[model samples]
Target: PRWRNIFKSNATFWWSFLSGIAQLLYVFGYLGAIRLTFMPTAYKTTHYRQPLLDHNGIDILRIESGYVACIFRMPSYDPSLPDVWQTDALISISIALTLFLPAVAIIVICSLLILRKLRIAKSTDISPQMRATQHQLLK
Candidate 1:
């Protein structure tokens, strides 16, 4: 006997459209959240007092109020610190997590569900064909 599960729809276009909308929403929400909340100057700087003149050749210290005046970032005039590389390092890790996390979660959930169904399929109620396939698989 065929497994007539209505969990599947005969309409391919509807599923495709739904999938496209879901993907677009995920991308838009992820990017929009990042854009809305991300601060360009979201870093701590170590203050240094120059004795006489330093490498950039000015004997004064400068500080500006942190603000996101516009989307485009102005060139940073602050002295480079060791922590600058940490931001760059986090970029790859963040990208990989964001891209694969949902996919991995879905795969894990589906695999668990399949395992559960297989466990129950050992019951005597299922079709002989499926039972035969089950026996073959167990072998």
Candidate 2:
């Protein structure tokens, strides 16, 4: 029974660590996706799966180039030009907050809970008989 209780406390600690790791992974995943979309990496091939056509029925083209560079390459240097990828930065930030913040919160809360549980368990009065038995067992 004593061993079982100790196991439970250790389990709580591990669960908190796992939750934090998951959140951190999610934040990185979102950032990586955005970077791949708007800010393509040199390693990831320029080509990714794209829809055959736009919503307006216009065909989409796949060029051997990065999207960010392509946007700036347009002639006339139109300062007022609308960007299709403008929302990506916002999405990245949102993902970072959603995944990373909650994970951190969960880790902190769980750790506090476990610590409280430990303190309470330790502060409980031990019966003289149980203490004697434990002492004999240790000897």
Candidate 3:
């Protein structure tokens, strides 16, 4: 009952609650979409490695220095690995915009309204002490 009254009376509290809920929903939806789109494979390695085989069931070595030459197989998309960071950044931006933009707008508007009200109140007040101070300052 008390919490309900607080939410009803406080615009800031309502904005925070709604923003948090929106953020949680966006994150869950994004995660669910990622899961549905990219099914996890048994081996998630980006690169595959194959050792050179010899006739004796051992790795073949170079004749000159006797060092094995390892073969690495990279996916065709390996060159685009840096784009993964960009995707993460995009997701971060989306989440921030969704979660914070409305709350920030509301806060800014509320602050402006409060400041305007204060200014109006100050202008309307004609206290004798304030009038005396104004006269002194004029002199």
* Predicted structure with the largest TM-score when compared to the true one: 2
> What TM-score goes with each of the models?
0.32, 0.44, 0.34
Candidate 1 residue-wise lDDT, 11-108, digit = tens = 33344444555556656655654554343333312222231134333323333533322222222346573222334325534654575567455545
Give the alpha-carbon lDDT of every model. Answer: 0.46, 0.55, 0.48
**What RMSD value applies to candidate 1?**
12.3
Ranking by lDDT: 2, 3, 1
How does model 3 fare in lDDT? 0.48
Q: Which residue pairs come into collision in candidate 1?
A: none
| lDDT for each residue of candidate 3 in 1-50, tens digit (9 for 90 to 100) | 78788765665555656556655666676555444323222232122212
Ranking by TM-score: 2, 3, 1
Q: State, as a TM-score between 0 and 1, how close model 2 is to the true structure.
A: 0.44
Task: Identify the superior model by TM-score, candidate 1 or candidate 2.
Answer: 2
What lDDT does candidate 2 reach at residue 52?
Answer: 17
